[model samples]
Target: MKRLLLERALYPLLGLAVIVVAWQLYTQLYAVSRIVLPSPSDIALASVRHFALLLAQTWPTLGATVLGFVIALVLGIPLAVCVANSRVLNLTLYPILVATQSVPKVAIAPIVLVWFGFGMESKLAIAFLVAFFPIVVDTATGLRSTPPGLLELARSLRASPWQVFSKVQMPAALPFVFSGAKVAITLAVIGAVIGEFVGSVDGLGNLLLAANSQLESPLAWAALIWLSALGIVLFAAVALVERLVVPWGHSGR
Candidate 1:
């Protein structure tokens, strides 16, 4: 188990290290100009020089992403419960949920800005819209997947409905819920960036826009790197929580 865990951790780092070295070698071999693609060293230097400003920009995007994800989480699980428990909602709303995802979030971003204005409100709405469906679908599947044997045992014990749900169904659903949350968190960041792209004056997306407009490739790469780091950090956080809450779920992984 320890060897498995160590390999899991080491493999990604090894892959990343190889990628970075190859990236550096390719740029050097081709004599690639910074205008087209900044070298990793250039990005590192730019990141160091502009760390404070980039961090300041990061705060707003991170805030928007978190708020949007929280809203998605608060509403999604209960809606899933309704859909899972009620035949009517499952038949009606499932189609609606699937349909919502069909409409492109980017195309609606301007209208969302119109509705919620240029503040973080629009960003929140965009993030929530982008992240909501995955959570609902995953959680509903988990809730419905409660084992028949477990349900029968709970009934035999004379457990109340609440007890059965809380003890058996919720636990069974948690790993799935976390899986959706992982996807949602990354979506939330992308949603925030999209909102910023459409209207906002600040955030990493805006920084990227400004940098690219100025032909500051290194700075743009820096912003892109920061955004990627943010997504990775959030995803890692969700994974950590999963390990703590659903230890047995790893057998499948």
Candidate 2:
């Protein structure tokens, strides 16, 4: 168990520590301006100084990210199922999905803000837009990729469509679904931050922007670190869920 923990956690921690130490040394040796590059210690100090403010701002971003990701999963999986199971739906909707994904989210964020106003709704919309594509694509792929032998065996047993789907296809697709989910969750954070950058009254993105405008480099860096931490946490949460729901997927790892 101890070795497992070290293998899973310690290597990454050590790598991050090395990077931080190198960053600090470089900044100190070069006497880099804080505005250009604040050292790790400076960022840490700023984080401590603004802990309350950071915590307060984090809630909005977290809420938007989680809500948007949930919405994506709720809608995307059903759409994917339809597309995967029906030739007609796949022909009609798959093209549309691809086209919509091709458009840049940044370009549409402002229009979304106009529609939903400068509020949580707009952020949610942006997050949903960015996170939706991967979920649909991956899920549909997974469903379609289920082993033909298993599907044929179910059909030979005279299983109903729903039963086959529930028992065979979904289990096969669990890994793919989780893969898309992990990607979508991270993209959701980026989406929320983009929305905040486009128009927002609060959030870590807003705080980072305000700090930059005020030339508070340390604070801006601190906000950036917090955003990274938030993304990591969300990603880990999704991974934990994957481990629970799809335990066999990680057996080799």
Candidate 3:
């Protein structure tokens, strides 16, 4: 366990070290233009200088991501339960959901843009689309495949349908629900970025676009860095929630 923990920490530390070394080497070795690839130090300075602007843009993107993810949870969990309960609904809707995902979000972006305009609504729609499927599929599987013995015991006890579901199905399904939530949170960030990329006046994605237009490579890199950080934060938040809510998961860990 100590070795495993050390090994996990080692990779990220080594990776960051390697990246910094390579960046320093590139800046010194090749006559790479700063315009094309700014030094890490340069990017760091730029980030500090423009911190307020970055923060201002970030809040909106964060808000949209949260809104979309919440919407996904509200919509997807119930839908999963519905499908889990009914073979007919599962047969009819499962394929369609799969198909919906297979279609590229970029293709849907314009339609969403037209319907919801270039505001947070379009971004929220995109985030919801990206997040919806995983939660539904994972939760459905979890709900339907609860431990056979427990389910049998519930049936034997002549428990009401609501009681069985509330006590057994949902609790058993929490782990799977959280698994999907982890995926959804990451996708939510990506979706918000995509929505901003397509057309938004604000967001880290917009910051990236604008920086690209001006050929401000360092600022763009800063936004990319922040975007990655945001993803990490959101993913960690879900993981923390999972650890708190799923006692079995914590005990297993």
Candidate 4:
């Protein structure tokens, strides 16, 4: 078990090291200009030089991602339960939900901005919109698939509806919920960045746009790196929560 886990951790680091080595070599061999693609070392320097500014910008983006993710969870799971339990709701609401996803988020980002204005509200709304669907779909599937044997056993015991749901259905659905959360967390980050790109005075996305406009390639790369790190961190956090919540399961480590 120790060896397996060690390999799991080491493999990704090995892959990253190979990529960095290749990237450094390519830049050196081609003598890549700083304007086009800055080296990893250049980006590291930029990150250090502007650490304070990056931290300042990171807060808003992180806030939006978190708020939006929470909203998705609050709204998605209960709706999933309702849809899973009620054929009428599933029929009426599912099509509309699917239809909304057909619209490109970027196209409607302007409309959301119009509705919520250029503030944190707009970012939160967009993040919620982006992260909501996966949870609803995954949780609904899980709820519907609760084992028939368990349901029969509970019913034979005269289990109350709430007892059955709280004890069996919800626990059974956790793996699925966590699956969606992993996906939604990444989407939340993207959604926040989109909100920042469309209109915002803060966030890594805004900082990125500003850097590119000024031809600050190193700064832009640094922001990009930070954004990628943010996504990975959020994803890992969700996975960790899953391990805590569903300790018996794999947690997809």
Best by lDDT: 2
Q: Which residue pairs in candidate 4 collide?
A: none
Q: Identify the runs in model 4 with alpha carbons over 4 angstroms from their true place.
A: 251-253
Backbone clashes under 3 angstroms, per model: 0, 0, 0, 0
Q: Kindly list the per-residue Cα lDDT of model 2 for residues 1-253, writing each as its tens digit.
A: 8899779898998999999999999999999999999999999999999999999999999999999999999999999999999999999999999999889999999999999988888888999988999999999999999999998999999999889999999999999999999999999999999999999999999999999999999999999999999999999999999999999988575
Ranking by lDDT: 2, 1, 4, 3
Q: Write the per-residue lDDT of candidate 3 for residues 66-154, one digit (tens) a residue.
A: 89999999999999999999999999998999888889988899889999998999998999999988989899999988999999999
Query: Per-prediction TM-score, please?
Result: 0.94, 0.96, 0.95, 0.96
Instruction: Give the Cα-based TM-score of candidate 2 against the true structure.
Output: 0.96
- For each candidate, the alpha-carbon lDDT, in order, equals 0.93, 0.95, 0.91, 0.93
Question: Where is model 1 poorest over a 10-residue stretch in terms of lDDT?
Answer: 244-253
Query: After best superposition, candidate 1 residue 117: deviation in angstroms?
Result: 1.7
Q: Can you tell me which runs of candidate 3 are displaced by over 4 Å?
A: 1-7, 250-252
Error of 3 at 10 (Å): 4.5
| Per-residue alpha-carbon lDDT of candidate 4 for residues 58-113, written as tens digits (9 for 90 to 100) | 99999999999999999999999999889999999999988988988878788999
Q: How far is 127's C-alpha from truth in model 4 (Å)?
A: 0.6
Which of 1 and 3 is the better model by TM-score?
Answer: 3
Candidate 1 TM-score, true structure as reference: 0.94
What's every prediction's RMSD, in angstroms? Answer: 1.7, 1.4, 1.7, 1.5
